[model samples]
Each structure stands twice: as C-alpha cells, then as structure tokens.
Target: MNVFRLFEERVAGALGRLADAGDIPAGLAIGRVVVEPPRDPSHGDLATNAAMVLAKDAKTNPRALADKIAADLRGDERVAKVDVAGPGFINLTLAPGVFLDVLRAAVAAGADFGRGGVDGPKVNVEYVSANPTGPMHVGHGRGAVFGDALANLLVFAGRDVTREYYINDAGAQVDVLARSAFLRYREALGEDVEIPEGLYPGDYLKPVGQALLATHGPGLLEQKEEAWLPVVRDFAIDAMMDMIRADLAALDIRHDVFFSERALSRGETDHIAATIADLRARDLVYDGRLPPPKGQAVEDWEDREQTLFRATNFGDDVDRPLLKSDGSYTYFAADIAYHRSKFERGCPEMIDVWGADHGGYVKRMQAAVRAVTEGRGELDVKLCQLVRLLRAGEPVKMSKRAGDFVTLREVVDEVGRDAVRFMMLYRKNDATLDFDLAKVVEQSKDNPVFYVQYAHARCASIFRQASEAFPGEPFGPQALLAADLARLSDEAEVEILRKIAAFPRLVEGSAHAHEPHRLAFYLYDLASSFHHLWNKGKDQPHLRFVNQTERESTLARLALVHAVRCVIAAGLSVLGVTAPDEMR
Candidate 1:
C-alpha cells in the first residue's frame, strides 16, 4: 500500500471539508502537495507542506491554515498525533498498528508491493546507442545499464515505457568497418594482411570474415571497391549488431526497438527531407553562412553557405548546420529526423541517455524537437559520465577484442552480471564512476550489491529456521496473518518497518525525477538496517526471529522478515539486478 499517497488524499479531503465550511476556496491547486518522511526521524513519521503551499491561494496565513488541516487529520483513526511545525509544516505520527497492517499488505502483494498503478502516460527511453564498430566498452556498458534501470523504474512507477536503441550504421564508421572486415576476409583466404591505420584493428572481425567467406565463396574478392563496399558493409553491420545484442543479453537487457539511422534517408520515404521540409514551411530553416569558428587563423577558415536550423531561436547557443558542404545531410540533421519520427509515432515524451561527450549536443537536439513537433514534444537528455575501469585501484585500459578499450563482456565475465549492473547504477548517471574490479565481488557489507542480495538471502534463512521451529503447523500467509503482531514492539524492528513503509513513496519520487540511483541508495539503507537487526538477534535470544517456546511471536517475526524480502526483491528487480535467495 502507498501510505504516503493515502495520507495525501486524506489531506486533500481535509481541505475539501474546509471549502465546504466556507473557510477556503473550492480548489487551490494541490498538485505540489506531498507527504514524505521527515528529514530528522525524531520529528515524526510523516510530514506534509499542504497548508504552507496553499496558504497564499487560500487567503489565510500558513499557521492558521495548518491548524484547520491538523484538526481534520487528528480526526483520522490512522493518525495518532498531528503536530504543526515551523512555517506551518505538519508532522504526523501514525498509529502503531498501521505499520503492521502495511506489512500484511506487502506480504500479500509480494514482489509487486511498491508497484504503481499501470497504464500511465507513455514514455520513451532511448539508450546505449553505441556504434556497431566493435564490442561494447565499459563506458558503453554504463550507459546501457543506466538506461535499462531507468526504464525499469519508469515501468514500476506505472508509466508505459519503450526501451529503444539507435543504430549508428549510416556513418563513415560503417565504411571503415567494411574495409576492416575485408582485411580479415583476405587473411581468412591465406593472404598476409596488416590492419592499416583508420580501420578497425580488433580480431573480433575474424569471425565476420569467416562468415563472409562461407557465404560468398571468394567471389567478392574479384570485384572493385564500389561493388564490394556495400556488400561487406551490410554484412559487417548485421554481424556487429548480433554481437552487441548478445553482450546486452549477458546483462539481461533487451530493447523493444532498435531504430536504424540509415532508414531515415535510404528508405523509399526520405524522412530527413520531410522533417526539414516541414520545418522550412514554418520558416525555421534557411540557407545561411556561418561565421568562422574562433581560435583559428582567419585565412585558414571558410565561411561556407549552408542550410541551417534556427536552433538559436529555441534556446540553443547558435543556429546549427543541417547539411555539409558536400550536399550530404549532417549527423545533427539525421538525429533531428530520428526524433521527429518518434513524435509522429505517438511518443512525444522522449528521454535519451547519452555519453558525457554528447553534453554539448543536448540543447540543440531539444530545440530541434520543438521546431519539428511544434511544442507538443518534450525531450530530457541524461548523460552517462565516463566509467573509469580499475583493477584494485590501477587503471585497466586495453582490450584485444575491442582494440582500444576494455570490453564490457570481459568485465561481466570476470565479476558476473549482478556486480556489473549494480555498480553501474550505484552512483548518479551524470557523475563519473570508478568501477574497481576487486571490490564489487567481495561478499561483505561494504559491497552494496552483495549487501542487498544478502538481505534477501538472510530472510530465506529465517524462513528455514521457522520451518524447523514450527514443525507440524503451517506458517503460510493465513497462519502468519493470524499471529499477534502486537508482540513486535522492538525499536529496531519498528525502524525496519519505517523503511518498508517509505518504499512506495520513494519509487514515485525516483521515477518522476528520472533518477534510478535513488532506489539503489534506498535499498542500501534498508539492507544496512536489516543487517544491523540480524546481528542484534545474535546477542539477544528474545530478539531472534524463531522461538520454539513462543510460536505466535515467531510467526509474527517471519511475516516481517518475508515483507522485507518482498521489498528488497522488488527493488532489485527494478534495478535490473537479481535478489539471490542464497549467497554462496
């Protein structure tokens, strides 16, 4: 159950009563009103700013409005105490039994406890659009994991989410890939070949060469450059994309769509031209000459005339070029068309998870979306910062398969997928992360993934102990729900209950903010509390989960343990990490 949302409705109902009594206006826009845990836990269980936020519109002082709201909330049997704090903030202390009731709800809901109502607005999250030039690097893996977790969080929070990947197969990079594969193809035919500069040097292309040989039977070797380039380029792209998909599957990530950049222009319908023409009709595109970039000698630069988009009018630093001097569409031009296609396909809300180098490109693309969609579109760009791959604090930088950087598959193979996914999202997406190979695999409280997964595993051990403690009698939901939970009055037990109660509210906030790391932090805190309480049971037998003499109390504690497992499993699932039932 969403206890915070429940209280928010109660607050709104109180304001409605005030309106009926002619004390305030009918509706004062309670959209900003929220119920959350107090910053200092000693203050109260729940707090709200409803009175303070609505004071000005209600034509009353915050203190006066807070008193009226407090009077109405104190009438709720759920709220044990309501105290008006500084600046008219209201802190509520819920009844003791209410928390136990929530535990029952969590047990009933199981892994879906904190899940939000479904069929909310559709949101498109596009990420990990790494070029199909090589095996994914650690930096690319970071973006993939971040985007996947963000999409999962959105789905948990009830948004209809679409996971998307953009293929960069239309660029000069693919031509280089074709030439590199041809080198391997010749080598496969027993010719001595050296990978020259400006082409890929990785041995990963060897398999592509073998596949080409098996298909073409040495026929393309006789053709000239023009004929063989297309044949090899398409073949290499398909192979590289297949390899990329397998790498992502190793981390349990799958996109609903993989949009091709080449289809924007090469298909029967040239969408790039249509997008540009649609904007040109609105006077948003024009032929103009751009000033020479700063810091270059004046004679060395040329102010060539080009087709440009009016990005400056929509808040970009300057108008952006849409076409190169060679009359080919620029990369930015193709990106605009790709995003416009998203809008036309009924996804006007878009989120792109890009690398740190793309930071400067965010505003211009956002501006393009506005120009093409006429303000119906909204774009949110979250840049995933560089991942510094380290082995015990030493930089580990080269991969033979990728030729330049350490491959993502190598790290996952070394540490497994759960460690990689958790460490990738353990920090904020925009902040640079140092992924230490040595630390994440440690089975200790210092390792966050291990700590969280162990919490679920520990809960399993408790159930095992209970199964032995209550040999013949059943301890299923019916029996556990019948237990006298009033015996669970320990301070540490109540603290864990507080964390469980705050989960649904946390999911809503993290989803709305598009920040999945918040769930990571919350899970760590919950695990810390659970581990602390588990250690407490070691010294004090009364605080232990199972008691052969106290059957009802043991069942009550099992219900609590099971509820924590439910929440942890649900949180880990949203993060694209596994909650192991046992940690070896």
Candidate 2:
C-alpha cells in the first residue's frame, strides 16, 4: 500500500541483484538509502539519494554510480523513466497506471487508506498534567492537542497507546488553592473575608466555595483551621479536576488513565518508599550533602546531609534530592514513583508532552525512567514551546497578575474547538505559535484550518452535484473505484492523482519523524492541489466535473474526487478533527 516504500524496496533489490551478478560491489550498506518526492515536481515523480549516499562508501564516483543504478532501475515495470540529476541524485518517474492504482486503492480503503504500521511496543503518552489549582490556559491547550494528536498518530502507526494525565493535586499549589477556596467559602457564608495576596483570586472559584458552604453549612466555619484544611483541600482539588475534565471533554480529548500522586504513598501502600528502597539497593540513593543550586541560591540552604538520588548516574546535571529537609518527598521523588508505575503497567516505550517552561525537567525525568527501567524502556519528551497571543499583528499581553490571562475555554469559545485544535498543531511542537483570535476565524486560505476543511467540503459538494447530474449513475465508493480511471489522463488530472498517490508516503514519513505538524503541512499541500483543480474547472470548460457529453470523463473525475475526500477524511481522523460534509 505504501508506494514509496515499494519503490525503495524494488530499487534496493535491483542494486542487490547487480551486486550478486558482479555488476557492482558487494557488502554495501543500504539502510540509509531513501526515496522521496523531488523538491521540483518537474524533476520526476520520486527522487532517491542511493547513488550519492553510497558513492563514497563503495569507492566509486557518485555520477558513475548513479548512472549504473539508473541503468539497473530502468528495467523495473513500475519505473517508466530513470534519470541521473545533478550531484548523483536519481529521479524515477513511475508509469501513470501506478498512480491510478494507488487512487483506486484509496477509494477502496476509504478512511483507512493511509493507516500505516504500528510500533509493537506499548507507548504511554502523558500530557496536559497541569496543576489542578486553576483552569487550563492556552499553553495547556497546545500540550493537550499535541499529545492527543501524537497518541493518535502512534496508534495509527501501530503502537498500543495509553493516554494518561498525572494529577498534581498533591502539590503545594493545591494547598494554596484549598486556602483560597476556604476564603471564598467564608465570604459565601455572608462573612467579610479578605482574599490573601498569594491565593487564587479568580471568580471561577466562587462556585467551589458556594458548593462547600452548601455541603457543610456553618459547621465547617466553626471548626478550627487544622481540621478543615484537609477537607477543603480535597474538595477544592476535586472541583478543579471536574472543571479540567469538562474542559478537555469540550475539546474531544479523553485520557485512558488519571494517575493520582497522592495515592502512591498513602495508607501504607508506600510505593514511593518502595521505589526509593529499590534504587538504594542499586546504590543509586544516598544521604549526601549537595552543592548549592545555581542562579538563585536558597537562603535557607542547610549544610546537613539530605537523602538524594544519584541522578548524575543516568545523565542528569547533578544528583537530585529525593526528600527535602522538611521530611516530605520532593516532586522529583513522586515523579520517579509515577514513572515506575508506567513501567509496571507494561509501557516499555513512553512519551511525555510538557510545556517549554518545564524544559529543564526533561533530562532529569528521562534519567529517572532510564534508571527505573534499567534502560529497558525508552522515554521521549516532547516539549511544546509557548504560544504568543496576538490580535492582528500586535502582541496581546496576557499577564495573570494584571488579570488578563487567556484561558483555553475562552480561545475554544471564540475560534471553536476544531479551529483551536488544528491551529495548535499547525506548527512544530518546539516552535512558538502565534495564535491570533481574529485571523484563525477568517474564512480564507491564510487560515489553514478553513482551507483544509473547505477542501473536504468541496469534495462533498461534488458528490452532491453528481447526485443531481447523474441520478441513475452510481456514485458510491465502489462505483467510482470501478470507474475508467484511464480516462483521467489529462495533465492537470494526472497532477491531482499524483498528489493523492503520495498520501501513504506522507503518513509514513510523519509517523517516522514523530511529527504531526508534517501531516498538517501535507494536508495543506494536498488541499492546495484540490483547490487549484477546482479553480481550473472555472477557466476550462472541459475540466468541469459535469461533462455532459462524456460519461467516461465525468466518472474519471468523480473517481479522483472520491480519492481526495478519502484522504481528507483519513487525515482529519488522525488529527481528531471532524470532516464536515458542509461548512455551516
């Protein structure tokens, strides 16, 4: 089904055959050989770097090697022409029937046309584990969208994926949230409560307070602070998690697991203590006096020896504290236990999608996973860079201190979940995204979501138009797939067929790179081709879909349309975006 992979295999086979016949050198490495679309379409259907990549290794001139490889490949039934271009690059143009067959396969497969091989190992994708103290913001949205898309891509690529979120309810921030909600609850009870400076001041917590007052009435207020803190803390944490679940549901994201950090060590289960003991057995933990942290030094820095993990043994910058001087396990210690849980869950391959602000944490976390899994498991950390809010061309300051921070819900409400998800993934995860509230909602090509969605809509319009034009003619997938595709020989029609033929290659490439943004880019290119063909029909009467005089031409064009629609649906499904039949 992957034409590019097939082509590469055939080319490599030819090279191996030549070597066996003493036409070429033996024992040449072929793993690095790659075949891809030429930068300029006019160059050929596909380009291979086999000659250039193998020349130095084989002790031969690149051009001479390319000529030999080209001569060997010319005999392939699928390869109609082979030419050696500049710098020993070999461009191969396949027979038009090859592309036609690919389009037919796409029509036959429907939305499953481009589903590629999956990784055999299980992958745990942990994302959007933002602190449960407040609502998710635009930054969290990026991580959520990126992580969800990655999980989808991996599953499509053949990995057993477990989408998970690590709850931060056990952190100091949630304790602050508890105090903040207590203040609001007192205020809701008709008391004059002064909001503390370091507590949450958002109006969103007022409901949590009111709910608290309704549940406990005046009895919670009568209780001393020590007795009520834990009660309110758990209540506020639960409410915050409820809000987060709703927010994620709004975006169509669902997690397979919600790991509670508090559950790791509570009630004598004591997995954190067990994990630390296991590390100690391996000589990875010790009570050591550590050097001061760089940048901002802690004024309360103690010279006393503290329990520390030898994180440097696994490539962290320095040994890290497992338990602080306050007799509580540090966040890193809990993280180790959490990752240990993933390994226990049989996740041999893992990916953590974190915000860019947590960039410094990646090395330590990866190091921990390595140590815990004894290098048996691999961890890939994808850090999403910050998104800058913009209105038109100007930067929109979003300072929470000034009470102007943009929440994820606000962005989703304004531009809608589809636009928000698509835009969030429209760029590389490590690259900064400029999310403009006004521009993304604009119905133009500049807005990629609209352009791609419009392509799907246009294909639907073709089907609808066909239903009116050819009422008795069959327009189902099977009918179009059985259409006379040989009639689709026009130069422009062939171009569209060629683009559709590249969908499998695109999927394989993007999945291999672990980059979903590549899918967005490829979708844009495919949509451009669809749009251009549509515009071409406006100028050339013969290119129109409703060629009343030629039934074969109409059927051929309909086949192409179905193929486009199938690819769009497949791509959107991978991105978790709905392909609307009509854009209302």
Candidate 3:
C-alpha cells in the first residue's frame, strides 16, 4: 500500500467535505493536489498542497482553507496531528499504529513489497542496438544496463515490457566485417595477408575465418569477390553476433528479441517500402531537396532531389531523407519501418536507449512514430552519455584484453558484474559518469553498491543473532508480521518505517519518469538510514535489535529490520543487482 497515495485520497475526501459544507466553492479542481513527505522530517510525516492549489479556484485565502482542511483531517484516526505550515501546506504526523501497519504490510509482501501500482499498455524498450560487427564497448554497456534495468523497473511497476536489440547487419559495416574475415580466411589457408586501411583490424575475427575453413573448406578462396562476399558476410555476421551475445551474457544482459535490419529488406514483404508507401499515401513523404547541414563545409555537398519525410510537420527540425543517393534505404528509413513494426505488433509504447551522439536523431525518430501511428504511438528516447573509465582518478586509456577501447567484459572481469551494473545506474543516463575502477570495488561508504549490499548482509546478521539469542523462537515473516510493532515507537525506528513506506511510491515515480537512477539514489538513502540506525545501537543498548532481556521489543525491532531488508532486496532486484546474505 502506498501511504502517500492513501493520504492523498484522505486529503481529497477532506476537501470534498469542505465543499459540501460551503467552506469553499464546489467543483474546484483537485487534480493538482499532492501529498508527499515534507522536505524537513521534523515538520511532519506527510505534507499536502490541497489548500494552496485550490485557494485561487475556491475564492478563499490559502491559510483559511488550510485551517479548515487541517481541522477536518484531525478527525482521522491515522493522523495524530495536523498543522498548517508556511502559507497553506498541511503537515501530518501519523499515529504510531499507522507506522506499524506499514511494517506488517512489508513483511507480508516480502520480495513483492514494492511491486505493481502502474498500469499501462505494453512497452517495448529497445536498447544497445550496437552493430553486430564487433564486441560491445563501454558506451554500449551503459546503454545495455540502462535498458535492462528500465525494463525490469517497468515490469515491477505492472507494465508489459519487451527487451529488444536491433542488429544493424544489413549495413556497410557488416560488409567491411566480411572483407576482414576473408583476409583471416586467406591467412588460415597459409597466405600472408595484410588488413587494408578500411578493414576491421581486430583479431576477434580469426576464429570466424577458422570456422569458415572448417565448414566450407578452402573452396571459397578461389571464388570471385561477388560470389564469395554474401556467403562470408552471412557467416561473419553470425559469428560476430555470437561473440556479442557472450559479451552481454557476461554482464547478465539478454534481450527478448534480436531484430535483424536485413530481414526488413529480404523478406517477402519489404517493410521499408511498405512504410514509405504508407507515408507517401498520407502525404508525409515527398521528393525534396534539403538545405545543406549548417556549420559544415559543403565542398562535396550535392543538393539533388531525394525522397524525404515531412518530419518538420511533426516537430522535427527538418525534413529527413528516406533513401540515400545510392538508392538504398537510409538508416532512418529502416528505423521507421522497425518502429512501425513495433506498432503493428500491438506495442504502442516504445522506448529507445541510445548513446548521447544520437541526441539529434530523437526528434525525427519520434516524429516518424507519430506519422506511423497517427499520434497513437508514444516513443521516448533515453540517451546515455559517455562513461569515462578512471583508475585512481586517472583516465584509463586502454583495455588489457581488447587492445584499444575498453570492452564491457574486461570491465566486468576487473570490477565484477554487480559493481559495474550498480555504478552504471548510480548516475542519470544523460549525465557523464566517471566510473572509477578503484573506488567502485572499495569496501567503504563511498561505494554505493558495497554500502547497500552490506545493509542486506547486516540484516541477515541480525536475524542470525536473533535466532541464537532466542532459542526455539520463530523469526520468519509470519512471526514478524504478528509482532507487537507498536513497541517500535522510537523516533529513529519510526524514521526507518517512513523510508520503507516510500518504496512503492518511489517505484511508481521511477517507472513513470523512465528513470532507474532514482531507484539507485533511493536505495542509497535507505541504506544510509539503515546504517545510521545500526550505528545508534552501539551507543544505546535498548536500541539493539536482539534485546534478549526483552523478547517482545526484540521481536518488534527484528520485524523492522526484516522489512528494511525486504525493501532493499526488492529495490536491488529491480536494478539487476544481487542482495547478498553475506558480504564474503
């Protein structure tokens, strides 16, 4: 149960009563009314803007309206005190029993404590559409983790989510990959070959060439480039995808679908042609000449007429080209078809996680979605900024294994999967993240993953100690749920409950805003509060969780600890990070 939502409904009811009593005008807009935790916890447990939001509409002074609302809320059994702070903000201090109710609910829910509350159409989260030409790098890893975590969050928030990866196999890059593999194949046949300037120089393709020799023998070596290009390209693309899949597996990222761009052009139905024809029928496509791009030399610029989409009509900066000068469909054209396919598959809610370089592509892609679905489809693009790899605050220039740029697997191997995943999500996707290899793995408060995981481990330690201190006494969820939670009346203990109560609301907000970083921040704050409370026990024996002298109070505190653990586990699971029972 969301306490914030519950209090919001309560405050709405109070406003309705005021309207009925003629204390304010009837039918004032209450949609703007919001109830949230006060910025300063000392002020109260919850605060509402009902009076301030409705004052002008109701033709009443904010303070006067707040007084009336506060008086009405004073009758609620759950609210112990209601006071108007500032001009019209009503702050509420809930009764002790209310906090106990949250604890009980948390225990009963367990891992499902913060699940659900959001209801919407199926969402397609397409991320890490990195070309299958090579292994995924650090930037691609950032997008992969962001997209996977986002999909997890959406699912937890009660939305149908499909994790997708778009493979750009039908592009020039794959052609280059084929030529590179052919050189390796010649080398496998004992011919000394030098990789040309425009070819892929990575040694990852050696195995692909060896496989080609083992499969088709050396017969392909004698064929013309035209005859052998397709066969080798197909084999090389498949091999590269296998390697890419392994890289993603190392980081625990798997996509529900791996869409091939080549399929759009090769299938019986030309999706790209179909998409362009549909847009043409709607007058959204036309032959036009685009002005040369600004702030660039146009020495080789050709202002020839090309098939274009009327993206400007739908909020894009300019009309976009549908096909390149070579008569092949442009990437944007295939992308539009890809998104149209999503709409055709009954997924109108689409989200794409791209690198920061794709920021300019956002508006045009969104405009295409609007044109395709007639504004019924909603596309949200989240661009993940670059991740600067650092070691002791010094720039990390190269990967130990990958030779040049850092590969995702190398980072995962060095710092571990949990540290990489959590640190990648610890910052906003649009913000440049400084991923310090030395700092993230450190067992200190500065390491958020370590601190959060340690909190879970500490909870397990408490339960173990409790089992030992109270022999033959039950300590599971059922026992904890039945504890006298009212015994947890300490201000510090109540503060813990307040944070636990915010979990569902936090999940809902993060899912709606499509921001998984918020969950990371919230988990850190919860861990900080939990760690602070654990430290307090060292100074005061009564605050100790395993109070053997007082079994009743011990059970109550244990219940609180279990609830905190449950919420932390739930949040970490959403982030695709483990909640370890023990640190070691």
Q: Which stretches of candidate 2 lie over 4 Å from their true place?
A: 24-28, 56-61, 294-301, 394-404
- The better candidate by lDDT, 2 or 3, is 3
* lDDT, model 3: 0.92
Q: What range of 10 consecutive residues in model 1 has the weakest lDDT sum?
A: 114-123
TM value for model 1? 0.97
Task: Give lDDT tens digits, candidate 2, residues 1-584.
Answer: 77888888987987898789886789899999998999998988999999898988778888998998898899878889998999899999999889988988888888888785544688899999989988888899999999999888877776788999999878889889999999989889988877768998887888999999999987998898899999999999999999999999989999999999999988768989999999999999999898777765688566779898989999999998899778999999999999999999999888899989889999999899999999998889999999998878787666453254778887787789989889998999999999998899899999999999999999999888887887777888878877888888778788888888788877777776778888888888889988998999999988887676777788889889888998888788788888988987
User: In terms of TM-score, how similar is model 2 to the real structure?
Assistant: 0.95
Which 10 successive residues of model 3 have the least lDDT summed?
397-406
Clashing pairs in 1: none
> What TM-score, over all chains together, does every model reach?
0.97, 0.95, 0.97
Error of 1 at 171 (Å): 0.6
Where does the lowest 10-residue lDDT sum fall in candidate 2?
396-405
- What is the C-alpha lDDT profile of model 3 across 4-65, one tens digit per residue? 99998998898889889988888888889999989998898999998898999988899999
